[model samples]
Target: MNISRRALCGAAVLAATDLLSFHVLATPSAPKIRVGILKFGTVNWELDTIKHHKFDLANGIDVEIVYFAGEDASNVAMLAGDLDIIVSDWLWVSRQRSQGADLTLAPYSTAVGAIMVKDDASIRAIPDLAGKKIGVTGGSLDKSWLLIQGLARRDHKMDLTRESEIVFGAPPLLSEKAVSGELDAVLNFWHFCARLEANGFRRLVGADDAAKALGASGPVSALGYVFHDKWANENPNVTMGFLQASGAAKKLLAQSDAEWQRLAPIVRAEGRELEVLRDRYRQGIPDRPIAEEEKDAAKLYAILAELGGEKLVGGAPQMAPGTFWALKT
Candidate 1:
């Protein structure tokens, strides 16, 4: 999941030609933007396209993409001024904001996490998870905490810290551990979860199921586009243009199966069918901007604060007023 910034930038240059054809050449007349993304999995359809310079050609803006191995690396790159934009989880953004990292939400990207058990495990529900060893990566930006929070809200305050033994490891290793029964449950993002179930592991809970259990309508955070505040301030026009182009891509992703198929191979090079990822994408992922992105971001901040992560700005991370970019009506 961790990638070098230099390698990602190289990938972006190659992707630009494949994605934008004639447009990338025209975009150099304008200022270029450099973006960083965390390489989390194989089916990074959105980020893959953006990283490859496909978006630059399509939007006529020269974009440079850098890949980090993990969100923490991407954050470090952003803090060190190596990247202008970062596409990461809301938790990373919230944690960064708490520590005084000036960043802005661009748009929501994904909406679900998968909770899986081994194929032979008798666990059928969240409550059945009592005393089981669960594997999750532990850190300030721990995504498992979000899943635990959702589970607690749904299953009558199940204390994850006490009820389940948590084993910390990187995501791929965690998935491997879960499959081998070294861990009873593992919480993961899209493709890993899908692969677990496809390989016969039982799904105890997913983002959508947890949302329904909590009587909520969506996942814990609206995953989406993010940018550094300083970068946006310095390159307002280019940033706005990037947002517009990203918004267009989001819309295009919704309307065109052909677009998905074309991009899927770039994302899943091992001949993984687009339909596998497409099903998960359609379930709860939001392609357009949402009024609740900031609200959900605030909620995530609150959860992190409760879990003793870090303090937000003004002692409480209030959603910055007018954070989202609205396309002209």
Candidate 2:
């Protein structure tokens, strides 16, 4: 109890330093969220914006964006644990979950795509696409194609794959083929479809209408941010933080047309291409999802179930419950 003043001062300084160390350990840098994206994919624009704006950092997540040549490459990398998340459709998530992948889907963009036909082509409606040479992006498992087939079966009672000459090609190649009259019509992704429309190609049925054509009640999730359920459960903060960052990005894009100009260069869109891209991005921003028991959710589920039945989703019967993670809620 008779310590010298110098010794007392040293002890106080040591205690303060230890407390500072504890604070540093308690609050380390944000957790890194490794995300996979395809080169030239539309998701790239939002993600790149997130990086430039530091939205992920603001939301307490360190986001690392990884690029893949295609979805196949991304899928392989994700399964190998190199990726924490990827942008994909709900049906794809369901199919993967059905196969026991334990994946969860968060609404990314509802921008389902569209079919583009010539301004003067005989094609006028969905059924008009029958017996015509149609170009499709992705492979036989493309969601747009599968949805179209489902529409054909439900409305015209025809199997489009059997009726139409379906040709699978890359999005750019498909666009070229359609413009050069090599294909009568081309089913393209949202951004590509927008460009084709801007270039004077007629917009036929878009995926939203395609969903209506197949009897969906309300808005359906066309594409989403997908992650492993186990990983998400283990790192709840990272998952929630990611969704918050994404929501902020979506809000910015949804509200500001001027913001589209900022992303145009990154997406390589210009002139009419830029306008189309802006419109599609705005249109694809989805409302917060409702409960699974809601009528709209049920109807959306049914549409996907039929599309899945057509093998668009690797032959899953229906979307397994818990496939959709309403993290925003």
Candidate 3:
């Protein structure tokens, strides 16, 4: 992470490429690492930075980005061999691994939701949410809300579904409703949470806090770079080099405010919203060692499994082994 700027920024920035630009930076003979990503994914910021610095070529690989309009399509492309890598949660990776697919994950983000609300003395904690209307997305599939339920059950002896009104809607709509005072509290995606924070809504309890309270040793990375273990074993240099490139890009993004300037148009936010978004993204970067992540993930998986049953964790009693992929040192 402390790699020198001289090393990463030596190459002239290349023009942005939507589909494939491996040839732009790498020699024709270099290895091509095909990546599937959502068309509007935040992952593009890092990929753009990687291209700007020519990190992939410098690290001995070429990156070909294949954009999909939906996450499901991106995931399908990975399994169908149309992609070498895709961004997804480790739980999905675990499910695949259990079903005899050798998928693995490299930690990407721990960003989740929070109970956001206006300053009101009556709403101090989970108990205070009793009889209050809570706006949430993903209905029963909202992991942050599920974790909050686990936290409330463990700490406050309350069932959020029974005590509070759970209003399920799309994130933007739920956020809009929360602002109008119709919803007492809202739990939405992290970016929406950042916008809400910028607009003066405070965090009551974040998913990370709930995770910690539920026995996770550290923050759990809910999303990661997923790929097949077999392919990585066959292509060690590309695998390790890409991971290094990713780390370098994250380092640049974390330290350089100037870097965010070029990123602003893609971020499409102005003023406080932009600042808050940047800060929140910085907070979500994965810093823990893989052992800690795996340990914490196993713990959280059990919690989710107990609360959500087979639907949440598939049929596996424990997180399938090799859920977290580490570059062999």
lDDT of 1 by residue, 1-329 (tens): 43332332223211222323335434447567777765644325655555454664565566666767776787777778877776665555655565577765655455566678877789887777779998765432455456455557556668766788877777779889887778989887666676676666767776556544434445544454677766666665676556555544544455567767788546552334355565655553452225454555555455445555343233544444434433221
Candidate 2 lDDT (Cα, whole model)? 0.72
Candidate 2 local lDDT, 93-121, one digit each (tens): 76677788888766666687788888888
Best by lDDT: 3
Ranking by lDDT: 3, 2, 1
TM-scores, in order shown?
A: 0.74, 0.83, 0.89
* TM match of model 1 to true structure: 0.74
Count of clashes, each model: 9, 0, 0
**Angstrom error at residue 311, model 1:** 7.9
Clashing pairs in 1: 1-69, 2-69, 3-68, 3-69, 15-52, 16-52, 16-53, 109-223, 109-224
lDDT of 3 by residue, 1-329 (tens): 23221232221111122223343445779898998888877889889888787878867888888889988898888888789999998778998999999899878778888999986536888899999999987678667888999999988899999999999998889999988999999998888899999997889999999999889888778888889988987786788778767876777777778888888888777788888888998888777766687889999888888888888878997999888875442
Q: Candidate 3, residue 295: CA error in Å?
A: 0.6
Off by more than 4 A, model 3: 1-25, 120-122
